[model samples]
Target: MKIIVDAMGGDKAPEEVVKGALNASNNPEIEIILVGDEKKIRPYLKDSDKNIEIVNAQEVITYDEQPVNAIRKKKDSSIVKGLKMLKDKKAQAMVSAGSTGALMAGGLLILGRLEGIDRPAIATLCPTAKGPILMLDIGANSEVKPKNLVQFAVMGSIYSKEILNKYNPTVGLLNIGTEEEKGNSVVKTAYSELKQISSVNFKGNIEARNIFDGDFDVVVCDGFTGNIFLKTVEGFGMYIFHQLKNEIKKSPRYLAGAALLKPAIEKIRSSMDYSEYGGAMFLGIDGVLVKCHGSSDSKAIENGINVAYNSVISSINEKLREGLKSVTEKGE
Candidate 1:
């Protein structure tokens, strides 16, 4: 399958993006299409590989630019072009480390949403206390309606079951307290609806602080809250890791323990990096769309490629079409 990669997005720009895409393309089973300025990309790529191609793009949207506005104005930007290619079926999926808003807008505006799907939500695999956790709406819809939350739950459930290998995964609503009446109006409404859905394994509300403690398999919330929650966890993980290292460096006994636990610490730290989990899947789209981390290295890019390939070959979109229709028919 052909997977399109926007080579202009992220902090490292063309170099890291190019290397990541090239490394992904190394897998003979898949073809990688890099969308960016060909003149720049060509020089970085010494020669040609059958699996890789550079599509010329004139402009690139920066993080500071308004996502939807930049997407509309920069018609030749790498993200928009790659999105168009997905719509045209020139690629199975589109991967970008660009403006999150622009990518979401382009996916809906260009590729369109699936049938029976309202707003699309972003779901990323996260490392949690138990194992991998699926967090929906990391940064898709900031403001959400009750119905939107229901849809997010539906989409997130399908993802957890199909892609994450979770059977009847416990779905949790991110809130301040574990009780049903704990959160604001949004959570109060969503909790009632989610609990009513018998098909889903609703496990009640999950507080933000215990999210990494693994209270549930899939956590659902609006992008606004989910984004804040994600960032806080990342920050906390980094702070604690650095603090532990600083302490260990000052004492011999602590340093000895640190040496002994280096492997275990690396494993834990790597698990929380978010990149190790690959990209965030844009649910409710007509096709799979993954938002790779801006600082994604070769391994993360490779995981994104594998996800794209599996998404296409598995006929995931087609299955979602059927699954969603089934749920609606059942009045879920």
Candidate 2:
């Protein structure tokens, strides 16, 4: 499988991105195409083998520029060029740790949306007490109709089942309350619609507090709510670790106890790490695209590439198309 990496997209461009690509290229069956300024990316590939290829892209779309405008004007940019390669079938997938706005815009403009999909959603794997739960529409579409939520649920289910290896994944709608009568008009309508869809194993509404229990395999929400939920979880995880460290330092007794429980603490820290899950998948896009964090390190980028590889090999897009078709046929 061939996967393209946006070499100049992230904060640690060219260096960390190149290192991640090289690491992922250790798999002989996978070819890594690094697209960026050749001069900057070449140095990291001194000991690289045949699986790695470099494509020169002179421009880079920055977070400051307008997303659509940057994509249109920066024809030679790594984001645009790498997306174009995917559109042209030169590669199976593309991974970028760049501006999220540019990646989403370029994805729609270049690769287009799946035939039956309206408004592609970003599916992110969130670590929970039980395991990883897939959440969708996180920072993708801030405003969405009821139908959009239904689509997110469908897409999230397919991804959970195929990529995450979940069997008959149960989906939940993120809401203020678990009751069917709860939430705003969009969610209420979505609840009614989601229940009617036979293709999805739609569970009732799930509150934010209950999300960590991992009772639901997939949770669908509008980007406005999902983004806040994702950020709050990340912030809280950091806060917990920070407070623990400060508390441990305050007392010698606590310090000794923390040292004894260091292994357990390290395991908890690993579970909370965003890099462990790689990156979010831009589901409903016509082609495979994985969007990594803007500040992603070599490890995060490497895992993101593995995500792209898995998506391509699993025929995720094809399964999604079929899933959507089934929903449409059922008049959902």
Candidate 3:
């Protein structure tokens, strides 16, 4: 499998991205294509690395630029070039730790949406107490119709089952309350539609507070709500760790206790780390696209490449097309 890495897309560009791509290239089955300024990306590569290739992309799309405009104008940007490679079937998938907007826009404009999907959704895996839960529309579409939510559910369910190895994954709609009567008009309508879909194992509404329990394998929500929920969880995790460190330093007794429980603490920390989950998958798109966090480090980028590799080997887009077609046929 061939995978493209946007070497200049993230904050740590070239260096970290190159390192991660090299690490993933160790797998003989995969070929790594690093897209960015060749001059900046070459220093990190070893002469012995034969599986890795570099494609020169002179421009970069910054977060400041409008997504669609940047994609159109910056033809030589790493984001655009990598996406174009995927569209041309030169690579099986592309991974980027760049501006989320540009990646989404590039995916839409270059690869286009799958036939039955209205709008592609971003499916992010969040660590939970029981295990990991998949949530969709984290930042793809802030506003969505009821039909859009139904599509999100369908895609999320297939991803959970195929990639995550979940058996008959149960999906839940993120809402303010657990009752079907709750939420705004869009959600209420979505709830009714989701229940009628026989393809997805649709559970009733799930509140954000109960998400970490891992009762549901997949959670569907509009981008506006899903983004807030993801960010809040990240902030709360940071706050807890920070407060714990401060408290441990203040008291000798606490310090001793913390030292004794260091192993357990590290385990908890690893579970919550975003790098462990790799990156979010842009589902419903015509091709495989994985978007890493803007500030992702080498380890995160490496894992993101693995995620893309898995998606490609699984032939996930083919499955998604078939799944959506089946749903549409039944509805019609």
Best by TM-score: 3
State the lDDT of candidate 3 residue by residue for 1-332, as single tens digits: 99999999789997988888888888898899999999999999889988999999999999889999999999999999999999999999999999999999999999999999999999999888879989999999999999999999999999999999999999999999999999999999999999999999999899999999999999999999999999998999999999999999998999999999999999999899898899899998899999998888899999999999999889999999999999999972
**Which tens-of-lDDT digit does each residue in 50-161 have in candidate 1?**
6898789989888888877887898999988999988998988888878888888888888899888889999987777798889988889999987788888887887788
Give the candidate order by descending lDDT: 3, 2, 1
Position 118, candidate 1: lDDT: 84
| Clashes found in each candidate (C-alpha, N, C closer than 3 A) | 0, 0, 0
The parts of candidate 3 lying over 4 Å away from their true place are none
Which pairs clash (backbone N, Cα, C closer than 3 Å) in model 1? none
Error of 2 at 175 (Å): 0.2
Q: If both were scored by lDDT, which would come out higher, candidate 1 or candidate 2? A: 2
Task: Give candidate 1 misplaced runs (Cα > 4 Å).
Answer: none
Q: List model 2 lDDT by residue over 1-332, tens digit each.
A: 99999999889897999888889989987899999999998888876367988999999899889999999999999999999999999999999999988999999999999977889999999988889999999998999999999999999999999999999999999999989999899999999999999889999999999999999999999999999998998899899999999999999999899999999999999888888889899999999999998888999999999999999999999999999999998787
Q: Clash number for model 2?
A: 0
How far residue 186's Cα lies from its native spot in candidate 3, in Å, is 0.5
Assess candidate 3 and give its TM-score to the true structure: 0.98
Clash pairs, candidate 3, are none
TM-score of 2: 0.98
